[model samples]
Each structure stands twice: as C-alpha cells, then as structure tokens.
Target chain A: MATHLILRKILDTGFVSEPPPAADPALRTREQDLQEEILKVFGQALTVRHVDAGSCNGCELEIHALQGAHYNIEGIGVKFAASPRHADVLLVTGPVSRNLEVALKRTYEATPEPKWVVAVGECGCNGGLFGESYASCGRVANVIPVDVEVPGCPPTPVALLQGILAAVSR
Target chain B: MRIGDNEWPLEQRPGCTPVWRGRVPAERLPALAHDVRGCGGQLTALWGSDDRHLGGGFAIHVAFGIPQGTAWVSSDLGAEAPAYPDLSAVFPQADRMQRAAFDLLGIVASGAVDARRWLRHGAWPEDAWPLRRDFDAATRFEPTLDAYPFIQVEGDGVHEIPVGPIHAGTIEPGHFRFSVIGDRILKLEERLGYTHKGIEKRFEGMTAEEGARLAGRVSGDSHVAFAWACCMALESAAGSPPPARAQWLRALFLERERVANHLGDLGYLGNDVAFGIGFMQFWRLKEEWLRLNARLFGHRYLFDRVVPGGVACDLPAGAQAALTDQCDVVAMHVRQLKEIYDEHAGIQDRFVATGIVKPELAARLGLTGLAGRASGQAVDARVDAPCPPYDQVKVAIVTHDHGDVAARAEVRFGEVFESLRLIQELVRRMPAGPLLAELPTAAAGAEGLGRVEGWRGEVLVALRMGADGRLERVHAHDPSWQNWPVMEPGVLGNIVPDFPLINKSFNLSYSGQDL
Candidate 1:
C-alpha cells in the first residue's frame, strides 16, 4: 500500500521542469560570456560554503529556500560545499558580530584563492537593524571584502539565485 | 502573605500574566527562592538592574511561575555591598543567570558555584560592567584572547572534542566541547555568547514602539511571538490594549509562524537523516506555505507585521478564501507525507530510539515548548494561560511519552496540523473592527510584563518606561535559555554521529539565547 501510494503520487506530480535560464537584457551578453569563461576555467560547476556571522537566521532561511524544488539550485552548476577549502565562493549572511569577526576572516582566508564572497540579506549588506555596537562590528564589508551584496530583509529565492550567478560570473 | 515565615508585602500588577511584585531583604533572597520552590514554583527568569540614579541602589529580580500566576521577587542590594545570596543551589538554572547578572551589571551573586564570566567574554576589562549607568556603549577594547578554562575529564580512553562557534552548515555560532571515548559522548559542554549583539544595552534610549522592532529581531524566526509579547508589555504599561480584531490577527500570525517553522524543521530533520526525498517534498511544501504567506501578508517571514498597539497589516478582501484553500491543500499533502515518513524504514531506524530525554529529567530542567511536549511536559501557554483569541478557542496540547527524536518529530507534525486548524478558525471568525488602538503615553517609571507562547516556547518581555516615555529597561527572555542546557543531557549517551539529529530535534535558538 505504501509503495503504491508513493508511485501514484509521483505519477500525479510528474515532471517538474528545471528553473528557466537567467535572462536579463542588461547583463545577457556579459553573463553568457562570463558563464562560458567560468566553464572553461572551473568546469561548469561551482561549490559554495555558507557562513552565518550573527544573523537573525532570516537570511539563512532564504538561503535554504534556494535549494527548494522551485529554485533547484543543484539543477544548475552550483552546489554547497562542506568546507571552505573545497569551495569556489563563500556565501555569508548577517551583520558581522564582533565575536565572529575573527572567525569570518579566518574562513575567508581558508577558502582557496580566486574565491568570491557574496554577502546575503540587508544585515549582511549594511548591518540592517543591528548596526555597529559594542557587541557587533557592522556589515560583512567591515570585516572581509565582499564581491556581491544581495540586499533585502531576507532576499527572495530568485534574488538569491541571481546573487549566486553574479558571484560565480565574477 | 507569609512565605516561609517571612512577611513580604506583595502588590499585584494587572497585565497579560498575573504578576505579584514584592520586596524582600537581601539576606532572605535564597530563602524566598526556596519557599517559592517548596510552593511548587518554577524559576522562570532572574535579572539584575542598576537603579543608582533612582536612589534605589542595585536591584535583583527573580520571576517564579506558580499555578496561579507569576510572582516577581525583588531585593535591593545597597550600593555599598551590591551582593545577594545566590539561588543557584536551589535552582540549578540560576547559576548561569546569576553569573550573567554579575558579568553585565556587577551585581555579585555571592556563593554562586561557577563565578566565571558568562557574557563578559573579555570584550571589556574585568572591572567594566556594560549595564551600569556610568559604562558607555561606544567604548572599544582590544580583544583579550584569553582562553576559557573548560573542566577536564580524566579517565581511561576519555578524550575531548571541540566543535564550532563555526560549523560546516549555515547555522549560528556556538561552541560545543564533548568528552568522548570510541565515538560515545561522556559529557558535553556548550559555550555560547558568540552572537551577543548588545541588544539589552541598545534598548536604553528607544521608546516602547522603537523597542518592538529590536524585540522582533531578537530571533527572526519567532518575530511575531517576540513582537506580540513586546506589544503586550508596552500596551499594558501605556494602559492601552489593541482592539479585538488586532488580537485575532496577532493569533493568526502566531499560528502561521508556528506552521512555517515546523515545516522547515521537519524537512531539515529528514535531510539530517539522509532522506533526500522527504527533504525535497517537505521543503517544497514549505516553499508553497511561504509563498502563501507573502501573498497574504506581503512578507515571507511576516516581519514587522505586529506593532505596539496592533498588527501592521490587515487581511485583504478574498484573502481568507485563498488561505482556506491553501490550508486544505497543505493538510492533504502533509497527511500523505506523514504516512510516507512513518512507513519509511530508514527514517524510523534513525529516529525511533535516539536522543531520549526522560520526563522527570525534562521537568527538572524546566523544559517547555515543543521539545518539552515531546517529553511529556505539556506546558503550553495557550492552554495554561490563554490570551485573547486563544482564550476563545480550545487548543489540544499534543505530547508523547517516549521523549525521542521520533517523538519530537511527531509533536511537530501534530502541532502543524493544529496550527492549520487554528488558522482556519481565526480567519473565518475574525471580528470586523479598527485594527489599531491609540496608545496613551505611559507614565514614567511604569513597569509591565508580557508573555506569549511562541512556537518554540514561552517568550517573556519585561518593560519599564523612562522619562519622556522612553524605555528604561527591556529584557526579552527566550525559551532557548531554559532549553539549551537540557540539550546537553539529551545527547549525553548517544554516539557523536547522531548529535546533529538530536540537536535539530531540540533546535534551540542561539541568537535568541545570546540576546
């Protein structure tokens, strides 16, 4: 009965298509050339390592949304790596806290060179609500150099995917 | 009334929770705690305040939850001494609270077993206390980089493993030191405060309305709960309550928050156990739920939805119908997924008997919320101390006696179903009225307390008005403070590999606790 139910459900919800390719008129030619160059240099795949430098976890939730069936980031050439050494880009979230400042710097240094750092969420971009304080050091740029900044309280999955593409293309 | 032969006069405050405020002699503080315990009181929270400007010297406040209401016991330690007898011997949880009090406000809890720094991680000098009036928030100090002395375990084949403050996944920072042998954990110690953002110190100059925004950000996932609690406290202080429609909307948001969190957790739990299909399915469902939230509420996580006097947004026309339809669809899909998850052999093998927290142990640790319910500690604020809309509707408290990973998962499933039902009822019967209420200016020095049962557990906020209607003090207590310590015992006997599964089952908030 269980197997039959699973089979029936799968058949009913058959063939969820992969997300359509990125199409922005402003960056169409540039992105296409960048995608080709990236494929030639690092193959068609890019591995990312995510770090949370004292966020409210809102941004992390949106980051997790990138892996949902609708986004299906894995269907493309992007995958989340378990360590910085294996990563081609680092996705950092939240306003960098004073306590995690050293850790963030160390994680950035540990990632292999020619790496990109994409700061996600408003907190990561400009320290959102929790700006500079005795306990917090401020935005991601305050501690480490960030390549791409995705600004939102918690950016949408589509925004996150675009940010990822922007980081990889860079 | 007399508490253990001590005649301490008490004054009752009318707010969300039944609060009795009284003063006791500094020496009798431990005795008062003991008496309260003997009277079946649980130590809810202990906080310290510097009232030198008010000529009240330093003050320590302890909240105890009894069957009738919450009793707030206060003792003023003169500025000369600034010390009180510790209550850690009576309530083990008070040990950390006392240390934190000392670290921040310089109020010494004399006789505390562990006097080591709790929150003051050498960010400032040894004598500098941030909470004191004289201390400045802009002061910068070079990192001391002093090593924390963790207690060592000495035995054959016993080794220590230190993990994180930085983890492999996109999780918050918190260090865990485990004493283990052959992959079996003998002892586990947690070092948090890595995410402390000076939230309490920053609340000094903000008004109650401004402080609500900070409260909501204390833990992003439980924004509605924290914001509602803050609003309750502020409204009570201002002698203004939101309209009936506003209360119903708050409940709706709270229920939606509950469902969203449970959906994500269920999926994460599946992924932890290597069940990719379950992860994908549950996450897909969660995405749909979030999309519905955005369509209805205009924000995915419902941020800034609940303000001081009422909710920020109202349900648009025909939105209720759309919500009802989505709820029906989610319920059907969730039911099917539950069947598949239950029948799956691998999930059961990983979930069934792992991470057991006995009921007695759970009660002793003062565990509450979803994890507490999983372990048979059925203390739901909606049922025990109902507020507004919850008072009108009946809530079924879900529990399991097994106290394992499977039990926690089942409790989450059951809660999601309940939340869906509550959402339907709340949306269908929402009263039509003004959404916002005009809040009167709070009297200077007026104090209020707010308590809301968030999806995680009870969220308590204590507010005091300063001159010009500014906030004097705002302390937001998350349930994670009580639940984090219990997580150590939950994972003691389990192998190291299963730690992630057990940890996720509890899923305590590091930022909430650190704040």
Candidate 2:
C-alpha cells in the first residue's frame, strides 16, 4: 500500500527530464556545440574525478550540489568517473596537507597524461586560512600543475561547471 | 568529598566551570581520577598547556563532566619529569587524547597503553613539539613522508585492503586499513590526521576577534556551531554576555544549520542505498533551503555569520515571514519524500540490521551527540545544559534503541522536523535589539569554556586570553573525536561493501577530528 502511495505521489510530482538553465547565453551555445565536438575529440563524455586533499568539507558540499537536480552535471556532457585512470580532469580541493601530499602526487600520476587539474577552492588556490605550515603544503599548485583555479571559500556549482568547461575547452 | 581526602582548594573561575586551581602531586592524580570514575564521571577532554613562561613547568588539565556539574583537575608536571599518570585504565577514550597531548606538547602519559603519535606523522621533527612555548610558528621543516605503523592483523587468511589517504570520491583524506577474509571484515583500523593543518599552533597570538574566524573554519560543516562556541568562550572570559536579541539570532542560525545538514544527509543516505529518486528530491529540497540561507545570510555555507559578542548580520524586515513560508513548503515536501524512503523495501533491506552498534557498546565507547542519541546514549547539550534561547524553548530529544543505519537515518529525519518546528517558533518570536555588543578586553590568563549543541554533536571550545588581549590558547574540540572511534565497531560484522553505507551513517568529519 505504501509503495502504491509513493508511486502515485511521484506521478503527481511529474518528471523533470529537461536540463538546468545555463549560467550564461554564450556558454550555452558553446556547451551545445561542444557536446558533439567533445564526443569527436575525446571519443566519449568528459569524465571528472574529485579528490579531497584536506578540505574542511565546505567545498565538498558544493561539489555534491552539482549532481543535484538543479545542476545535473550529467545532463550536460559531463560524468564523474570513479577512478583516476578513467578520468580526464582531476578536481582537487583543500590546502594540500603534508600527509596527503604524496597521495595527491600519486593520484595525479595515476591519471593518464593529457589530463587537466582544477584546484577548486580558496584553500586549493592559495591555502585559504591554512597557509603553508609544517603540516600543510599551501596550495594545490605547490604539489601538482593546476590548469584552472576556482576561487571561493567554496566556489558555487555554476563556477565549478565553468571550471570544468574551461579545462575541457583547453 | 572526591578531593576532601586531600585538602586541595577548589576555586570558582569567573567565566569557566568550577576549577581546582592548585596542583595535585603526580602520584595523587590517578587516585583523583579513580575517585571521579567511582562517582560516575565522564572525561570530556584532556589537554596540556606549556606554562613555562608563567611558571617553571607544564600543566596537564583534565575536564570531567558529571551528573552534578563540570570540574577541571589540573596537575603540574615539572620540566624534568614531564610524565603524568595516565587515566586510560579508568577511561578508555583517554588513550587517544593522551597520545595527542604527548605529540603536540611533549606531555607524556606514563602508563598509557598506546604511546604512538596520534596527530604527528613526520610533519615536524621528533623533538619539535608545536604546542610548546619554545616551538616557533614560522619554523619550516622539510617534508618527510614517513610510514605510520598501523597495528596489523597477522593471519594466513587475513589479507589487507588499504584504502586511500586520497579517496576516489569527494571525501577528506583518511586511510582505512581493512583486514578481511572472503569479504567479512576481521578488523578495520583507521589512520586519520592526514588533514591536520596545525590549527592549534595557528591560534596563538591571534586577537579574540581573529580567533573566532579560525574556529569557524575548524570544520566548515559545523561553521556556525564552532563560531558561536568560540564567541561564547570569548564573551564569557571577558565577563560580558551577549544581548537577548543576539542570543535568539544565534539559535535561529543554529537551527537553520541543523536543518540544512540533516536534509543533505538524508539525500546522501538515499543515494548510497541506491534510491536515486529520493536523493534528487531531498537534495532539491536542501538546495532550496540553502538558496534561502544565501538570501538571508550572505554566504551559502553561512561562514563568519556568528561573530564574537553577536552575529555579523541581522534578518531583514520581511525575511522572517518569507522564511516561515519556505519552512512550511519544505516540511510538506520532506514528509512526502520521507514516506517514499520508509516505503521502499530495497532501501530498508540495505539500511536496517546493518551497521548495528549496541547501546551498551555505544555507552562504553563514550559516544556523544546525534549518533549517541541514535544509539540510545541520549545526551544532547541543548537539552541537558540549555544556553540562552534553548533555555526559553523546548527541545525534543529523539532516541532509538536499535543502533543501526536505519536508526541513524530515522534520527536525522526526526531532527529535521524538530528543527523546522524550532525555526518557525524562533522566527515568530523574533527579539529586537542591537545585533552587536561591545566586548571588553579579557583579563590576562583568564580562561572560559564554550559548549554548543552543533548539528553533528557538541562543539566545545576552551579559550585562554593572553596579555594585551591576544589569544594565549584556544582548543576547539569537535564531537567527532568521540564518535569516530565508535564507527569502527559499527562497521564490524557487516560485509566490506556496506562500509560506505555505515561510514555515511556516522559521517564523522576528518578535518574536524584531525584539527
């Protein structure tokens, strides 16, 4: 009975199969054209793999938001890969902690070449509040080569999308 | 009569809990701990201070929260004899705290079973104690990627599976070593501190105002809690309480924070259990709530909103009415989704009877806050020790006897509804006054304790103001400290694939615990 009720409620709510609104009109055209262009170039959708170096989990929260219905990153030609070997972009957050420095390096190496790194927070860009200490190695660039940097305590989901687009475009 | 046997003078501090200011002989410290344990006391926190500048020796402070009230037991350990009697025999959780104290401040707990460094992992030299007065903050040490010796389970069938310090998913760095035989986990040992950024050392010499900002960043998810607690500690130390209006606003912020996190967690739990539809609906609701937070407060995460003396911003004229309407709509949607979650048989199969932590085990492990409540430990700081607005408003403590993943999810669902109710009441009874109060400079050597019921659990901050109104020491203790260890037992007996589900059920903060 409860299952039937749930099905009825879901039916009442209706489907939201359409993609979210684009942040910019120019970007929308680029995204639409890039979908086929990316397929032609990469042979598949752009796959992103996220790595949390030592974030406060602030950036991680916003990153999770990107997958929500409001900003379905998959709706646009992007999917989050589970492994670094399968990923085209490495999204790293937090000030690189000393203990995590080697691990971050190893993760970067694991990803196949022609990969782009996007440092995705204030900490990721310039070590936000936790600057280079004995325990921290400052920013993501200090450890690995970063192609794009999204700057916010936690950059919004739209900014993250832009960062992904910027990386893939390059 | 605990200290009556020895004529130790107990003095009341202006802004702190009752304190036994005078030192106890190193030999007599264990006896006092035993006596406190006999009277059913729980060890809240254990920390060491480098008092060499004020005196010739370091001081070890252990705080005990009992049925009566909170009390601090301080004992002096001379420079030559830095070892103090370990309380691990009496209280099991003291094992890690003692190790942390030894690692940071060079205060040794002589009889503690585990002497391994808890927070230190070759980030600094073995001789360099960061919390010590002589340790310079600017000194940079060469990075040494030294291997940590995790306790290995050696057997013919016990093959180890080493998970990441850098995980594939968007999670903070923490290494999990699992010893398994055919998918059944024999043991799971966690190696955290990968996110330790020397926050305690960074807090030194900061003004009280600046320290509040640092506290908020201690764990971004519990930003409001940590900031409010830090502010409470500073204000208490200065003997100045914030205005009633500010107190109500703080409560408002806290409830909103609670609702946001619980909603987000419900969505995540659903996603983990393969209910993608539920995940979308719940996350959609959470996004709407967060958008409202951005409209009300400036930031999406509400960082730096809670400041010393009062909140940085106040609600606008029409904001309350709008928020009230939003809450009603959110509540209706939440009820609808929760029904779906409850009715789903597949979700129940994954959630129920999985990650079960018995009430007895939870109690023995010193579990606190929300996870504890789910497991029937039933300790909520807001209800137990009401502060300001909570004193005026009632909080319904939710508890479940079955300590499983389903129970934890149930607790989250219940808490979301309670928070919604609280928000409605708080917004309706909005107080009017100046948002910010002028805080007086705290006296040198003055210490204060701030305990707030954060969304996750109790967020505690201990602050001591140095001369010239600078921070002498500030230790922000997250409830994750107590909860993380218990997560090990919760995952036991469950298959390795269910690890993520169990892990998400507890959802302890790696950065919070590491800091």
Candidate 3:
C-alpha cells in the first residue's frame, strides 16, 4: 500500500492538493503566509522544465537527485516536463551562452504566461568562472527576466524545492 | 607508422625528424595521410605546443578519422608560420577544425578560405597565441563580448525561433537558431562558446598528472574518457605504462560511465516523445546508478578517480562483487522496461522514422559513435583501434542501417549488454598490482598522442612537453565536435516536435565541444 501510494505520488501531475504538515512556530509569518498561498494555488503539485543557457551539469546532478529514491521529490508533487509549454515553472541553470541566447528567448516565449523562471546556480546568477569568455553572454538576467535565483555551485535539492514553492506563492 | 599488424613507428609522421630521443623515422608522412583519406576520414583535432628539452621545437599534433587508427600528423612549425594543405576540400568536416587550428595555435592554413575566429575573441592580443611556447598562464586578460556577427535567416515564410544558451533544465548552454517555415525547420544555425572556462589555457605549466584531472573536468559527463585519454598520452610521452590490472579497472569505470549515461538518455528521449512515465522511471534508475558510482567510487559523476600513471582510487574488496549484483538488477529491470517500451505501439510510431539519417549522408558528413554506428557507420574506437585491456578483449561493433531514433536507442541497448559483459570479465580476472605508478619526470621536449574509446565514441588527447617538463598545450577533442555538425543535416526534414528526439539521438555534449 505504501509502495502504491509512493508510485501514485511519483506519477502525479500538477493537479491535486497534498495535505500540509504542521507548521513550525519558529518560522516567520511571511514564510508561513507564503507557504499557505503556494499550497492554495499550486496545491503541492508542479511540473518543472530545466533550461541550460550554459552549465557544467553540476547543478543538474542535484536536480536529478531530487527525483531519486532518497529525496523522492515526486512524493511532494514536483515533476519534470519536456516542453516549456507544459511546465509550471522554468528551472534555469548555468551562465547564458551567446549561442543559446535566442533559443532561450524562444523557449520563454513558447511558455505560457503566469509562468515563472528560477535561476539555480552561481553561474546562473552570475557567470562564475566562464564570465570572461568571448562567446559568453553573462548571467541568466542578461538574456531573460529571472523570477528567483537559487545560488550554489549547484543548490541543494531542498533549496531547489524551497525556490519552487516560493515561485508558486508569487 | 603502420609497421605491421596494429603497431606503428611512433613519431614518424611527415615533414621532420622525431623530437623524442627514440630514433623514430620521419619518412612515413605521405602514405599515412593517404591511408586516412582513403577511408573518407575526418580530421578530429589539430593542436600544438612548444618544448625545449627534447630539442626545443614547436610540435603540431593532428588526429585523423574514427579510431581504428587515425594518422597522427605532426610537424615542427619553425619560426615561419606552420602551414598544412587544406583537407576541407576533401572532407568538409575539416573546415571548423582547420579554423580552430589557426585560431588557437596560430598555424596558418595555406588553402583555407573561411578563417573566422572560433573560440577566440578580444581576450588575448591579436598576435598573442595562447597555445604557444612563450605564452604565460598567470597573465589575465579582460575580453569584450560586443558585436558578435550572428547570421540572419531571411525569408517571407521563414520565422526565427531562438532557443537558449540558457533555458529550463540543468544542462549545458548552447544557442540554436531554427529558421522555420510553419512547423518545418528550414535552417538551423548554432552559436556556441558560452562556457569557455579557459580549460586549455589553464593546463599550462601543470604536471601531466595534475593536467589529467583538469581534462576530465573539461566535460563532466565524459570524465573517465577525457582523463584516460590524457593519462594515455602523458604516459606514452613519459614512457610510463600502466599495469595490466589498472587497464582493466579503467575500462570497467569507462563502461559503467557509458551505461549510466545511455540509461539517462533513453529516459529523456521518452520524455521528449510525451511518455512522462518512462522519463520518471528511467531517471529514478539513473539516479540510483549515479549513487552506485558514488558508493563504489568517490564521486557521483566518477570525477577525480582517473589520474595520470594509473587510476587514483582502487575498488574495495566487496565493491566489485556489489557491482556484479547491481549489474544483474539493472539488466533485469532494463529488460522489463524494454518489454513495456516494445509493447507500446505509440512509441514505435514516434521513434521509427523520426529524423532518418541516410547512410550515404552520414558518410558524407563523417558521423560517428552511436549516431554514425546507427546509420551503418560501423566505427567503434574500442573495437577498431584496440588499446590496452580492450586490445586483448574481443569487441563486436554494433551497427544499424536505419539511422533513426529507434536504431540509436537499440545501439545503446546493445552497448549496455556489452558493457556488463566487459565489467564481469574485468572483476573476475582482476589483477594484483599497485593501482598507480609514480609519474616519471617528462623531459623538456616530448610529444605523444593517446586515444581512448570513451562512452560517447573516440576521445583523443595529444600532449606536448614545455621547457622543464611542464605541459605546453594539450588539445582534447570529444566525439561531439564531429557529430554536432551532423545534427543540422539529421534534423533537416524532421518536424519541429521531433527535433528534441533527433537531438537526443545524437546527444552531443555542448560543454565538451565549447571547451
């Protein structure tokens, strides 16, 4: 029964609401309000599309880990979609490359409005070591309007989850 | 250097005396060049560096075609500019490589017309060549990223669809301009070089051992391949051969890397075709495989495990046994998944003829690895150009005439089985020896070429020693450099929706190519 529930949860799309856990009294009011608003709107269900303007795949590994057995993001209602159109939020990683600028723009255009773009990684926020290349186009902000930036060499999976929840609240 | 069956006279290719002290002849140039062209060869890499100890001459390195042995064409570009007759007229794929040779090494190609600067923009001074003998690694240069000339796609019916250097999903960055007519793609232009981390420039002055680690990191996915190739080249230059046991371990790591990636690709391809279940399940499996890598090895991505002289990490006593058990689990699970995939009629329709790459066209563009092998180009660097432990083991090259998404997936399946078999054999006959030997101090002017069959295809690393035995300039070329061009032609008639499927079929590494 647990396995079936886990499988069902893993297979769930961004449609139904999930039961909320008890909130921590230590959390700020705004944080609680944000969580409530996000659960109310997205209902613990979301599909994410990852975009690589240009990345080293370091962050992608962490993202992949979220969907793995240990963290099991599917249990919470987040899924990865192929096309940007089907995605509720765009998970952007890497410093945007010159070659990928136009493709990035078109992808954003194809995605329906009421969509959010979350930059996840130091490179995504600002072009880390790849900053001074002739073919580079700086950070994610240089090319597209980013909603939230989750910074790390690659942000931890929980951080990514937090960022996703934050995006749905807005 | 083809002396007899498989062995060749090393460092005896065209134009001059051998730099190393081994008395290798320099007379075998013309026939070597001819042998490559006869097979409709593609020039994979062109790199050069200066060395002073062996003889103090600038050495140019060139790797020709898919591995069953490509000619290693090298020469000393004396005070005057080094020039080579254009191979682009013979092999159209040589155009970018030749331009890269000129752009990076300052080697002037006599007959080449299109000399656009690739991977070099206003960072280094006009005359300052980064790969040269006199180049300094400590020097910092600020580059201006203004006024790049992106080609315009013009027509009444044509609409431009620009896709990222940055998009959703945590993948490498590259820009693609699709000139589409309605839903059909007319012209697809690619602009790359966003993540130029100065990898090549960073290798300067480092010991060959340290340099191998950097090479592996150049592209995260093919870490083993790149690291192995760098080690092979450096070892060859230093005359340091890894023990028979170490070779087997390297191959084992290399094959696991291959299998892990292929599984991920299969799942992603399914997702592209609207089968989210396959994507989720396969990705789950992929993550498990990565965790296994971390458990057995140190890194989840298997980085830093492969170093010069030999592998950095040795498998624990139970690790090999655990890997065997995991292999069985993977095979059984994959078989069940394959059954579902085969039963699904919709998947067949989507993958069958979507992005068909004709055999003749594949040959024309010099396609290789899985994409080329799928299209009837039976070239496996491991099988054809046997190296170390692979040299002893028999390998059956997998090929398919129908170069579609289905065929590519099938080839991947075949490789997974072969990888399992090889791993079983490696663990069973595991040898006892020091996993690594102390790297020899390379002389001032030694040059060597190392070729390893990386999971993606053939990975080539050419090394040249600088003054005091430090690295001069090392050129590492991934199979993506040859296959990325073919993506344009492969996707020519395919619909826009099928573009991702076709792109996934090739799965070229932008990080590997951009560096």
Residue B41 of model 2 has an lDDT of: 58
Task: Provide the TM-score for each candidate, comma-separated.
Answer: 0.95, 0.94, 0.80
Badly placed stretches (over 4 Å) of model 2 are A14-40, B1-29
Candidate 1 runs further than 4 Å off: A15-40, B1-8
The worst-scoring run of ten residues by lDDT in candidate 2 chain B lies at B14-23
Kindly give the stretch of ten consecutive residues in candidate 2 chain A with the minimal lDDT sum.
A23-32
Clashes of each: 0, 0, 23
What digit string (tens of lDDT, one per residue) describes model 2 on residues B385-495?
677888788899989989999999999999998999999999888788999888899899888878788999988888789999899988888888888888887888889
Candidate 3 or 1, higher DockQ: 1
Question: Candidate 3: where are CA atoms >4 Å away?
Answer: A1-54, A65-170, B2-34, B39-41, B48-60, B66-68, B78-82, B121-129, B132-156
List model 1 lDDT by residue over B1-515, tens digit each.
55544565768777655677788888987777777767655677888888999988999988776555667778888886699998878877787778888888889988888888877665677788888888888777776784678889889999999999889787788899999998999999988888877788888989767899889989888999999999998988997889999999999999989998899999999999998766777888888889888988899989888998998899988899988888898899889989988988888999999999989888777777899899998788888778888889778999998999999999999999999999999999999999999788898888888888899988888877999989988888888888888888888889999999999988889889777
Candidate 1 C-alpha lDDT tens digits along A80-128 = 9879999988888888877788888999999987777888888888888
| Model 2's DockQ score | 0.64
**Candidate with maximal DockQ:** 2
Candidates sorted on TM-score, descending: 1, 2, 3
List iRMS for all predictions.
1.4, 1.5, 6.1
